[model samples]
Target: MKVIAINGSPRKDWNTATMLRHALQGSADRGAFTELIHLYELDYRGCSSCFACKTLGSPSYGRCAQQDDLAPVLRRIEEAGALILGSPIYFGQVTGEMRSFLERLLFPYLRYSREKRSLFPRKMDTAWIYTMNCPEAAIKDAGYDRVFAENERLLKMIFGGSCFTLTSHETLQFADYGKVDADMFDPAGRKARHEQVFPRDCERAYELGARLAQNISRGLPS
Candidate 1:
């Protein structure tokens, strides 16, 4: 079975991408064919709200109508057994790229009828990773939890799939703290914490990957 991990970070090798790679490695170790996609590399827009996907007799019914870089990616997702998406928090929300990607990814499944069903595959297992500058203890205060939680809800309610989440908190923002005026954060302290905790976070991501693969293979909740 194939598993696809999409990185929503513009920096391909930064924290978000690194965590996704670890998760993919875990899936790979469990014998699932894995591929990684960097969303920023593609030229695409969010759903155009064309309504063609919802129109009767439309050839592209229940699918995104925009023919762009994301169309093929959507096809890949439709065929995959599992999916993992990672993005860094931008101003308490997902980056514009990630938000656009999600709009296209999930909007096609929405319908106006009473049936409340979507076109998404019935059995795909999914996970979301959010990296943030806010400390873990301060997430609620920052109110970023609502954004990611709503995203998780979309995966579960629309897709009827098991959803997992990971957050890397207080992420380092620069190679040298002195170069930027990050006065609110203790750069040295944040760096030290990241050094101590990131490895463990990666381990958790690996576990998530392995567990997702196993559960998806068995057609069970992860």
Candidate 2:
């Protein structure tokens, strides 16, 4: 089985990327062929609402007709057993780049998931991995629930799969987080807290990955 991970972080080795990589690494250990795509390095735009993809004779069904770097990526997503989408929190939600990418990425998947009705026996599973400079309290902020909830619903509707979210809040300092980064979601700048929280986050993520992979192997989804 194969899994594709999309890294929506602008930085190379930062929290979002690290979490995705580790999740894929755990999947690899379980013999899942894995691939990682860093969207920042690609030249692509959100999506053209052009109805070209919906044309009767168009070769691509729900995917955009404007071909760039993301077209091929869509095919990979279709064949993969699972996907881990990692993004850094921006303001109070996923980054624009990641959000746009998700829009484009899900377009074709949405067509397949909704139109192809034989998905009763098995389906793909996807997880969201994220890191932020804010704390859990920040996620609980008054204004953020709607945004998070909307994204969660969109994920489930688009992927025809279950969703698992792993998040680490308050990740501003790389060094501080690295201390416990091997296993947890400790924020970067909070040195003392980093040592305590990072490992747990990592462990949780690793376990999530394992469970998701096993689900695919057993024709189940988490």
Candidate 3:
């Protein structure tokens, strides 16, 4: 099985990327080939809304036509047994890069017909990992749960596979809070959580990846 992880954060060694790396490591330990792609390194635009993907009889039908760095990544996803997306919550939503990536990745396979909702070629496991600076209690109040649910729903609809999510809250955002002008956060608390809780979250991410790989190996739906 092949598991691919996409990091949507600009900071490669930060919370979001760390969670994805742990997940990929778990997948690898389960005898699955794993790859991680960082979106910030790529130059690409979101879906152009040209409708070439939706146009009947067109050569690009059911596929994104944009020729860019993300296009090849989309093609590779077609052959992956599982996909894991990691992003830091920014302004109550995923990072802009992640949003754009989703636009290109999911739009093409979306069927407009009433009978069929997706044109994806096969079923595969999909997951989302979100790292946020906010506390866990604030998620529902901030309506972030709704965002997570909607994304999960869309992935399940388009991929025809099981979808799950992992969220790491109260992530440490800076090495030294005193260096930045962010007085709203409690540096001591953040550091405490980083030392006490982040490892638990990383362990959960690893378990998630292992479960996906084990399911794929056993011919079970993820």
Candidate 4:
């Protein structure tokens, strides 16, 4: 089985990327072919509201019509047995790049009819890994939990498979806070949590990936 992880953070070596790497490592260790894609490295636009994907008798039906860097990535995902998406929360939601990526990835397969919900070719497990500077206790108050749940719900509906979410909270945002004028956060506390809590979060991500691979191998639902 092949497991693919998409990193939606601009910084390739930051928290989101690190968690995704750990997840991919776990998948690879479980005898699954694994690949990691960085969305920022690809030049792509969000869906253009083109109805080609939904138009009857169209060749592009059930597929994204735009041809760009994301085209091949989406095709690769079509072949994957499992997928993981990782992003850092910005302004109470995922980054702009991730939002655009989701638009391109999900819109094509979404059916307008009530009888059928998705046009995706097969059933596959999916997971979302989120890193945020906000504390876990504040997630509900901030309404970020709804965002996460909505994403999971959409993935489950579109792919016809189980979907789960993992979140890393109070993430370290900078290597040296003194270099910037961000006085709203305590740099020392964030560093301490990164050293203590973030490692545990990475371990959780790894376990999530390993479990996904194991389930696929065993013909079990994730």
Candidate number achieving the greatest lDDT relative to the actual structure? 3
- Tens digits of per-residue lDDT for model 3, 1-222: 799999999999999999999999999999999999999999999999999999999999999999999989999999999999999999999999999999999999999889889999888889999999878999899999999999999999999999999999999999999999999999999999999999999999999999888888887885
lDDT, candidate 4, residue 80? 91
- Better candidate number, 3 or 4, judged by lDDT: 3
- lDDT (Cα, tens digit) per residue for candidate 1, span 1-222: 888999999999989998998998998898889999999999999888798888889988888889999999998898888889899998888889989998898888877767866667576779998888888899888887788788888888666778889999888778789989879889888789779988788888999888888877787865
Give one clash count per candidate, in the order shown: 0, 11, 0, 0
Could you tell me the lDDT of residue 108 within candidate 1?
82
Give the 10-residue window scoring lowest on summed lDDT in candidate 4: 213-222
lDDT scores of the candidates, listed in order: 0.86, 0.74, 0.94, 0.94
Using alpha carbons, what is the TM-score of model 1? 0.96
Give all candidate RMSDs, comma-separated: 1.2, 5.2, 0.7, 0.8
lDDT (Cα, tens digit) per residue for candidate 2, span 104-218: 7765445433466322224678888878776788666646657666776777776668887788876655664455545555343466555667667777777777777788888
Q: TM-score of every model? A: 0.96, 0.83, 0.98, 0.98
lDDT of 1 at 110: 76
> Which candidate would rank higher by TM-score, 1 or 3?
3
lDDT of 1: 0.86
- List of clashing residue pairs for candidate 4: none
